[model samples]
Target: MGGPAPPAGPGTAGLRAVRGKSIAVLGGGSLGLYLAGRLALAGHRVTVALRPGTPAPSGIVAEGDEQWSAAVEYADIGRLRGPYAQVIVAVKSHDLPPLLPALAALGDGATEYVFLQNGIPWWWRGIAGDGLPRARQVVGVVVQHSAERTAPGRIRVRRTAGDRYLCGRPDGSVDAALESLAADWRHAGIPAETTPALRRQVWTKLMGNATLNPLSAITGATVGELATEPATRAVLLAGMAEIARLAERDGAGVDNTPEQRVARSAEVGGVRTSMLQDRLAGRPLETEALLAAPIAIAEEYGEAVPVLRTLYGCLAFSSTSPERNPT
Candidate 1:
């Protein structure tokens, strides 16, 4: 799934009509609240879907160098009113199974589903086969922002680097709705663009997560700490090199070397990887999707990923052991 990249920049006249549509954002995580708040402030009728008993904030407050807040309606996942124009999924990969069936029940051929999650998405093949009506359009999103939940109903955007978001069709086809959605995001101060090389982009992001996330989780170190320590740095490079080879085998070759990735990590300094953050918060680690899945693919392609396998084992044990304090 690849093609020429789309033109860059904020808005075009054609996409001005994209606002004020009814959109449902699934999940109450920092990213989800940030997105729902931004979309609501952008004039879209935003509805946030949360699990039962999760507090439905009267409004979401986005804090960083500045502050932006917006009131958004909330709905329980099982009680969502149907036929949304677009459904933005911002849940963790591990939490997607139960939500998938509900999403399928609400979406139809014309409804557009946008997925924003770490690691590989389960619906990469196509949402049609996942019990959804064949008419639904699926767009994959690569979110590059660093956001954290500081408190209930509040989120902080810690860092904004490169493009804020990348949207593309999973099947590598162009859709006007996708382009318009990207434009809308751009107009709302979120740097977003449409790309045809969605799979390559996904693998490129995976290169960093597959290495840094688990390593940081295991060592309880920030990216900078991992980069500067000779021992951890060696493990980091070896794991990334394995992922690079796997990417090549999968025909999604990444150009950045492991050292280059480390250099980029250095720029982020004290920021901890998401897995490490989850560990500290006593939340479940996303090892299966972020680490094990890639290793499984590498094995299927007859490639060795010993470092990844080892990291996966360590993370699996750490997350489950009763004696360990993840923090």
Candidate 2:
């Protein structure tokens, strides 16, 4: 029911067409705050549900290519109660478990649960399979915004241009609410849209992530370094080729070639990947979803992803072993 518009597209043409809707963002990370701030500016009543003990800022401030600030209500995720128009689950896959009950509870009244995770959702089989009612809708977002938290309640959007937020339901069904949100996001200066080819979008994003993220974390390289350095770049291209093959076999082929994906990523310049940031900060890496799950899928299809496997082993070992602990 929707697609991408040309650059310089839909500049607030229908900004006031849709009324403000209630939205609950379940994370206070860079992406979550950026979205919350933008949504509030779009006139939505946005509440960012932060993790317990995390300070709630009086307002959110965004910097870099895009700049703005907005006020949003905050709540401890554990104690969050809601009947918002939609609930955006913006946390990583590893942090999703404890939030399941909140989701199940919110499912009863919220129009949809929008998952913003990177790798395959555990609920891919069916959101309802997790005991969510069939009547409840679930959406997936493929985020292209390269951002990081610069300070409490502040987000630094790293990429200078071409930030797109692609959303779609798992069943590829048309979602009017999402379409409306997309339009408003565009008007608010964030490139966003909904697409029927969501699975393709997921695979396409995964192709880049699987290739760049692990390499970045392992070598402490930024996106540009991984793309330009011959040794790292070779491994990156090899891994991307493997994932592309796997995606094709699964019937959700990536849209671009490995080289094209890498070239596009090079545009991001020296921005550190989320994985690399997590590694440096001593936070748990999302290896299971980003690497293990894909590796498992490859194994099931009798596909070999030796480069990914090697990267995964190194990352997994470091994440768990004492060698990674700061003295």
Clashes of each: 2, 0
Off by over 4 Å in 2: 1-18, 107-110, 130-136, 321-327
What is the C-alpha lDDT profile of model 1 across 1-327, one tens digit per residue? 222233322222232334498889997888788778767777788899978878777799877643767789998787888788788898889998867767766666667888887887786555555565353377788876677787777887665355357788876666777787776776555667787777777887887898899888888899888888899889988988988888788786875888888877777778788888788888887888888789889878999889999999988888787457445
> Model 2, 77-108: lDDT tens per residue?
77766677778888888998777755767645
- The prediction achieving the highest TM-score against the true structure is 2
Task: Give the Å shift of residue 210 in candidate 2.
Answer: 1.3
List residue ranges in candidate 1 displaced over 4 A.
1-18, 125-130, 133-136
- Residue pair clashes in candidate 2: none
RMSD of 2: 2.9
* lDDT to native, each model: 0.77, 0.77
Q: Extract clashing residue pairs from model 1.
A: 109-135, 109-136
